[model samples]
Target: MSSPSSTLGGSKHAIKLTQGLVALFAFSCGAIVANLYYAQPITELISPSLHMSAGSAGLIVSLTQIGYALGLFFIVPLGDLLENRKLMITTALVSIASLAAASLAHSPGWFLAISLLIGFSSVAVQILIPLAAHLAPDHARGRIVGTIMSGLLLGILLSRPLSSLVADHFGWRFVFAAAAVLMALVTTVLALTIPRRQPEHQATYFELIGSLLHLVRTMPVLRHRALYQGLVFASFSLFWTAVPIELTRHYGLSQSAIALFALVGAIGATSAPVAGRLADAGHSVRATLVALSAATLAYTPALVHPAFGVYGLVVTGIVLDFAAQMNMVLGQREIYALHAASRGRLNALYMTSIFVGGALGSALASPLYERGGWTLVAGAALVFPLIACVHYWFVGRPHAHGRT
Candidate 1:
C-alpha cells in the first residue's frame, strides 16, 4: 500500500468541493459542534449548584448523549426522505431553544431534560456531514471532509477551556446562553447559504427504520465498523469523564487547572483531518486500525499506576482522541461511499451505535473509577478497541464491497 497521505491515490468516487465552500462549511461545523460540548467544562459547577449528587450530576451529560443517539437512529435517516437544507435549519433553531432552556434550568432534573433536547437537536451535524459528502466530487471528499471535521474537532477541544473560563468569571449560565446565541447565528447562516437537496426516500417512518435494520443485518462493513467505533466512543467518554476528578483528587488542582487539562486534550483532536486525507488516499482501513491501536495504547499507563499514570493518561488521551476521530471520519466516509442513496441510513447505523457506547461510558465511568481506581477503568477501555480490531480484521474487511 502507498503512504497514507499519498495525494488522494486517485480514488474516483471520493468527494471534493470548492475551497471557498469548504472553508465556509468547516467554519459552520466548528460553530455547530461547539454547541454540543460547551457544557462539558461546567459539569462540576452545575451539579453542586443545582443540589445534585456527584453521580447524578453526570446525568445531564449522559442524557444529552442519549438524545443524540436517538436523533442519529430516528431523525438523521430522514435526510434521505426530507428536504435537508430546511431540516438542518429547523433543527438548529430547536437546538438554540434547547440551549436556552438548559441555561435557565432551576433544578438538576430540569437541566437533564433540557440537555436531552439540546443533544437531540444537535444532530444537525449528522445531516451536515452526509450532505457534505454528497455535495463534493469524488476525488476530494476526504480533503473536504477533513476540512470540515477540523472545525468540529476544534470546537470539541476548545469548548472545555473556553466554557470553563467563561463560567468561572461570568457564571455557568452565561456559557449556555452564549452558545445559544452562536447557535442562532449558525442556524441563520445555514438557512441562508445552504443549497437544497430534494427528498429521495419516501418510506414511512417504520419503513425507514426497517432500512436501518436491514443495513445492520446485511452490511458487514457497517456492522464491523460500528462495533469498533462504538467502543471507541465509550472509551473516549470514559477517560474524559474521569479526568476531572482525578486531576482534583490526586494533583490537588483547582477547577481552573482541571479545565486547562481538558483543553490540552481537546487540542489533540486536530488530528482528524490528516486522518481523513489518508482515507481519501485509499488507506482508510489501515488508518482505522492504526487509530484504534493508538487509542488502546493510550489507556496503558492508567492501568499500571494511578498517580503517575494520571499524567501519562492525559498525554495518551490526546493521542487516543485523535485516533478515535480519525476512525470516525474514515468509517463514515466508507459508509457514505457505499451507496449515495443510503448515506443517511448508513450514518444512522454508524452513529446510533457510537452514541449508545457514549451513554454507557458516561454511566460506567463513575462506578468503574470508584471500584477499581484508574486501573480497571483504563484496563476496561484498553480491551474494547482490541476486540473491535479482531472482529473487523477477520470478519468484516474480507467480505466488503467497493464504496463510491
Candidate 2:
C-alpha cells in the first residue's frame, strides 16, 4: 500500500483512504478494544481465584470501565496534541504491560490495579478512531467511521465468547496472556502502516484538558448525542455483564455454551456500518429513533427467560447489541462532524460519558442480579434506553431536522 503523504499539518486535502489501511485500522481497533472486554465473561472465574466475594465480582468489569472512562477523559485528548501514530503505539505498549501483569496477578487488589491500567491504555482505540475520522473526507466520514466502528463493535461482541472459550480450556489468566501477545502484534502493525496526523490545535495540555468542559458547555449537539448514547450504552453494559451469570446460574450453561451464546450476539455488530450509511444519507434522526426504540424493547424478552428459555435471552442480546451499536456509530458520526481539529477532544468527551455509564451498569450488575435475579436486571436495563427514547421524543426531534 502507498504511504500517506508526509506529515499532514493543517492540510485542506483529506488523505485518500485505501482499503488496506481501512482493514488495518479495523483490525487494530478490534484487537485493542477487545482488552476492555476479555475480563467481562470471566469475572466469575477470576473472582473466585482472586478471593473476591460473589457480591463484588462485578467490580472486575466496573473497574476496567472506570479506568477506560478515566483514560477517555484524561488521555485520549492528547491525540490532538501528540503525533497520532506514536501516541497510539505508546498507549498500546502500556496496555501490553498491563495485560502481562494481569496474567500474573495473585491478589484481587493487584489484579484490579492492572485492570485499570489495561482500560487506560486501551484508550488507543479511541485515538485510532478519531485519527481515522481526521483522515477521511467529509462525504465519506460517516461510512468510514461506521466501517471502522464495525471492527470495534465486533471486538466488543466477540471478546466475551473468545475469552470464555479460551478460559474454559486454558484458564482465565491465559486469556490475558494471549491478549497481550495479540496486542503486541497489532501495535507493531499499526506503527508501521498507519499514516501520521499532527493536529493544528495549539494549546497547553492543561488548557486542552480544561477546554473539555467548555466544549460540553458550548456544543448542544455534543451534549445531546453523548447523553443519548450514554444511556443506551449503560443498558448494553448491564446486559453483557449480567447475562453470563444469568446463563450460567439460571440456565446451567457451561462456559463453552456461554461462548456460543456470545457468538450469537456478534450478529448485532452488522448494524454498525448500516448505521453509518444512514447517518451519511441524512437519516440519522429516523435511525436514532429506531435504535432507541429497539433498545427499549430488547429487554422485554429477557424478562421472561424462564418461560422462553435461553432463546429469549438470546433475542434480547441480539436486539440490544444491535440498538446500542447502531446508536453508537450514529453518535460518533454526529460528534466527529462538530469539529475537525478537536475530533480527539470531542470523541474524548463523548466516549468518556459512554464508559462512565458503562461503568455504572457493570458496577450494578452483581448486586442487582443477586438481589432480584434476571427480572430486576432486565427491568433496570429496559429503563435506561426507555429514558433516552423519552428525552429524544420530547427534546431531540425538534432540533434533529436542522442537520442535513
Using lDDT, give the best candidate's number: 2
lDDT by residue (1-404, candidate 1, tens digit) is 11111111133124345687677787787777677677665787898889988777867768888988998888998888887887888888899999988888889778888988888988898888877777766777777777788777777777777887888888999999999998888788778776677654567888988877777887777787788889888888777777766666667777677677777787666777787788778887677778778877887666665556557867767887787888888877677677777787788889899888988887787788788877777788777777777776777666333432
Q: What RMSD value applies to candidate 1?
A: 5.0
Question: How far is 372's C-alpha from truth in model 1 (Å)?
Answer: 2.7
Least accurate 10 contiguous residues by lDDT in model 2: 1-10
Give the lDDT of residue 13 in candidate 1: 27
Q: How would you encode candidate 2's per-residue C-alpha lDDT over 1-404 as one tens digit per residue?
A: 11232245446364567888888888889999999999999998999999987756667788899999999999999988888888889999999999999999999888888888899899999999988887787788889899999999899999999999999999999999999999999988887777778766788999999999999988878888889899999999999999999999988999999999999999998999999999989998999999999999998775655688788989999999999999999998888877677788999999999999999888888889988999999999899999999999999876553432
Candidate 2 runs further than 4 Å off = 1-14, 401-404
TM-score of each: 0.91, 0.96
Q: What is the C-alpha lDDT of each candidate?
A: 0.76, 0.88
Local lDDT at 133 for model 1: 76
